[model samples]
Target: MRNRINEEITLRKLEVLLAYMETGNLAKAAEALDVSTVSVHRALHSLEEGMRCALFRHEGRNLLPTEAAHVLADVATDVIKAMADGIRATRQAAGYSADHMKIGSLYSLTIRTVPDVVIGIKVRRPELQAELVLGSNADLLFKLKQGAIDAALMAMPEPDPEIESIALFEDEIYFAAPADSPYARQASIDLRQCRDEPFVTLSEGFITYQGFMDAFRIADFTPNVVMKVGDIFSLMNLVSGGVGYALLPGRVRDVFAHKVTLVPLSSQYRLRQTIGLSFLRRRERDPNLLALAAVCRLAMRVPS
Candidate 1:
């Protein structure tokens, strides 16, 4: 029983077996493994002895594998591949020499901020591949905490000790309307006057939606929301089509310049969204995160 317990399979022995099976001769297997033919023969003999099975048969000067050897080789191949995959995954989780990065951001930033950051990162590390994960502020934050994303570019939330946040720029909230609407002509729109107007806004998890609620709350009323969408572009489309009024960040003005008009909110309802980069405090030393932070700082200086 003790001998049986001691005779366990090993990765090195399995590799030698696979090399022998693929090359079909001791001299060839030795050449493939860069070892002596005697070493390859010894490994196979030890493996066969360990298993207490006839894995090969002697046919003159050449050794031929039995059916059991073929079966063991197939299973060994899978085991080797799985171990390699696990090693790669473990290294990635540790943030060691990763060639791929996952970046999370709000849908609104795709127009400029995200593109600028990605371009800068590419210039710095041409070999790195970046995948963008766009979602609401809440969704992105959730993913960041879960390690599903490397970092997030979003409206800054309240300070948290566990997160490392770098502020990029400030964007003011504006009252958005169709170009032909009467409100479009106002220098600064008063939220109090628009109390009864129907509004179209992004869903609850979005930062803009929170700004909308905050601005309205200050004006002492709840908005008459006609519809709620998930993305800023769609909300802009609704506002442009005259579906309803909306409160949007000033950053969106450039992309929808022809379709909608953005008027500054009156002092009573004024709010600004501070866009920033957020990542786990523990991962602050990660090379990818360091590159992203440098790009964000450069962008901040250029006026966003």
Candidate 2:
């Protein structure tokens, strides 16, 4: 008779055990399940813990299933098969099979990067709709965590244990100023030079805003910030009208180049913002997320 164990064993754990039972090796089980060997090992360990029994015994170099393992594996076969239909129904109920993919990003990206990426995705998949949400780095990451959005494009998002991110590319941060300003005429301006300059900045909590503050910190001076706006374009418009100097991404040079100058900074003040794609790790297998990520990676390469 098989020893009774804890009922906390999950369907995913059972699926891992069934894969291992049929394959006879970790590599084979991982390959069949399309997961890393580490994931397989972890699931197997959890399964053993849940059942409160040693399921496999080390014999020579092989891990052979024990009597308990054999009994659980026999029952797991039917359970795993039944759960497949259950998963499909649940996914449908959760709108996982929706036609549109909701993508979240900062307000600044709307000018160039985000639009191009959406176009690129549609070019590849004509039927797939792209829904965009613009917000601060904090907002986008929160929606991603809550599953309100499938993915997010953010810069140096605050580290969270529940979310996983892949940095897509690096964009240099530039000090934005009027074309005729003394700072613009210089070959390179130090952040120290801007300490007395009235600055137009994005509202705090934005990654752009954070980078702006980092430069000030490195320069050991507080900036005379005169305005804190919500979006990059608004900040640029104010800078164009000569309200104040602002720090911006190099990507904005083309759009504002007519009235503004993208001056390079000294090494001390130069900061490259890392733009990353983040999604719930559990949904890494979703085809829509995979496709959008591929498009975004490609879009970052083509000049915006």
Candidate 3:
């Protein structure tokens, strides 16, 4: 009997019941629901018939809920709230007047790539605002998955199934030291030669850090990392101060051109990092976000 009763209940009937509960009169409930009084009365009758009991009893001009109706009303309230939340989420996902787009990126690209992308997007779509979040690759990926950020620019290809990535550019990694350092005068330095020197590098989870380690491993030596920092600026600062040298991307060299001297790596392994733009595949079809991505690709000169 309960299963049969539950099966007959519809969301529309529940909504009418809630409206009646709020107004205590059919005419007013219909007015609140933006329907004719007859429609409201019919919905109430259907709800009562489906439940196999009278949900409300008219006392004079007022209607009062029966015990079953009281219980169902509580449940209906929760269900209605859930439905409303679902609607809100759906609307948000559909980009219905959403004010800002949140973007995440590794610190290395934030100084150049991200700013240029933002500028280009604003130039094209002046009404759309961009919020930028800067962090490590792992941190940005985590934030993107959690929906704290809409998209991210980082080294790729990421193996996460939830994310879809587009290759932006391939940047070569070069060994850099202070201009007066012994290695600066050389056209290139062998990875094995730097094995004994103290190295300043990005912390783990960064592509550059992994590339540096891999380069050393390929050269049959392990680097002595004296310090691990979060951002390239700090790493370059350390290198400038001669605390230690580092393996950095060519983009970093472009940004910090005069601060340090970059020496090419004489490795056959082609120590290069591929930058990519990543976002959830589910969100890949969002028109606004797609447009923003298009502008970003244009700004970065990422090949389509």
Q: Estimate each model's TM-score.
A: 0.72, 0.68, 0.69
What's the CA RMSD for each of the models? Answer: 6.0, 12.5, 7.0
Better candidate by TM-score, 1 or 3:
1
lDDT of 1 at 25: 84
- Clashing pairs for model 1 are none
Sort by TM-score, best first: what order? 1, 3, 2
Look at candidate 3 and give me any clashing residue pairs.
Answer: none
Q: Candidate 2 has which clashing residue pairs, if any?
A: none
Give the per-residue lDDT digits (tens) of candidate 3, residues 1-304: 4435465689999999988888888899999989999998888888888888888888886778888888889999999999988886886775443557888888888667887888887887787788989888888888888888888888875587889998888899898898789898898888877768998999888888888888887888777888999888999999988999899888877665676998898956458888888988788887657877797778777421
Model 2 residue 260 lDDT score: 94
TM-score of 2: 0.68
Lowest summed lDDT across 10 adjacent residues in model 1 is found at 1-10
Displacement of residue 102 (Cα, Å) in model 3 is 0.8
Model 3, residue 244: C-alpha shift (Å)? 0.5
What is the per-residue lDDT of model 1 for residues 1-304, given as tens digits with 9 covering 90 to 100? 4444335477878899999999898889999989999989889988888778999999898889999899989998999999988988987987654889999999988888888999999999898899999999999999988889889999887788878999999899999999999999999998989988999999989999999999999999988999999999999999999999999998889878987999999998899999999998988988888988998888767545
Cα deviation of 169, candidate 1, in Å = 0.7
